[model samples]
Target: MRYSREHKLETHARIVKKASVRLREKGAHGIGVADLMKDAGLTHGGFYAHFDSREALVIEAFAHAMDRSTERWRKLAEQTPPQKRLASIVNSYLTPVHRDDPGHGCAVPTLGAEIARESPKTRKAFAAKLEQMIDMLAEQIPDVPRKAARKQAMAILSTMMGALVMARIAGSSDFSDDILGAGREAVLGRATSPKAGKPRARKAAPSAPH
Candidate 1:
């Protein structure tokens, strides 16, 4: 039976969302298209109806995952105070709750390695979302130049992602907690203002060197 356009779109969305979760839980290549479709309550044969190929589904799924992550950070940042926004974000991300829920957490640490080896199209799509995430993070930083803030955000995110991977590898041991703690401290340090709650004012240039 043919489905209506709206229904088809809804079903396609369901598949992408399901795939997003599964792809994070499992590695990028760990689960096949059939399993993803099955999880989405559809048949493997119907996968092509929504996507041109497995890679297509993966690209969309990865983008969906990153979008969800960005939305989450946006909400958190909204609730947090201006000066503390970046710290709040870092703390939220480095906790056990976030670490234990890769399916719902940030996609960078979970899917970064696999995406590294994916087709250029997939990597390009991932990079596009990654750029948005970096920008979102940069917005949380205060008392810094935009270029410097973005650079700091990128460094902070990279450190956190690597620490998260290590923490996951270490499991629930002290090592895991240590990794998380270190990650939080390292990133939060960058996010923290040197003087705390005070902006560094740029000095005025002398008038035409008089």
Candidate 2:
């Protein structure tokens, strides 16, 4: 049956998004075209109708995942004070919760090593999205020179990604949360954890008349 262009476009997007999440959880080469198609509720033969090649799907999906990650961080940063923007991003990203959920968290820590080994076209796509991320991060650091801000953004991302990788590797181990905490502290100069935070103090009582 012939599907309308709109239907086709929606299906294509669905496939790409499914591929993005699965690939983040399972790595680029971890899943196959047939399985990815299956997860998208399409047959293996139907895959060719949407994408030219599995690598094409990989490129699109990786870009999709990176775009979502960037959008999330941008929204989060915008909601905070200008000076606290970077720290807000760091605290949110370098958390044990993010560390524990590869499928839903940032793509870099899960897919970076695999991306390095992908074809030039795939690598190019990855680099393009990465530039967007760096730009977003740089925008959050208003106090530095643009060049230095870019560099700092790179440093913070590298530290966060590395920490995420290490934390996942040590998942469920004693130091998994520590790894996340250290990463947050390294990026923000202090750490905050949803787990370790104290309850808000009650309002102070009015002073008695002297």
Q: Pick the candidate with the highest TM-score.
A: 2
After superposition, the stretches of candidate 1 with alpha carbons farther than 4 Å from their true spots are 190-210
Per-residue CA lDDT of candidate 2, range 76-191, in tens? 87678899888778777866567667887788889999999999998999999999999999999987899999999999899989988998899755588778677877887854
- Model 1, position 70: C-alpha lDDT score: 86
Find the 10 residues in a row with the least total lDDT in model 2: 201-210
Q: All candidates' lDDT scores? A: 0.80, 0.81
Estimate the TM-score for candidate 1.
Answer: 0.88
**Candidate 2 regions with alpha-carbon error over 4 angstroms:** 194-210
Candidate 1 shows a clash count of: 0
Query: Which residue pairs overlap in candidate 1's backbone?
Result: none
lDDT for each residue of candidate 1 in 71-170, tens digit (9 for 90 to 100): 8888887877899777777766776566677888788899998899999999999999999999999999999999999999999889878888998899
Going through the candidates in the order shown, the clash numbers are 0, 0
State the displacement of the C-alpha of residue 130, model 1, in Å, after optimal TM-score superposition: 0.7
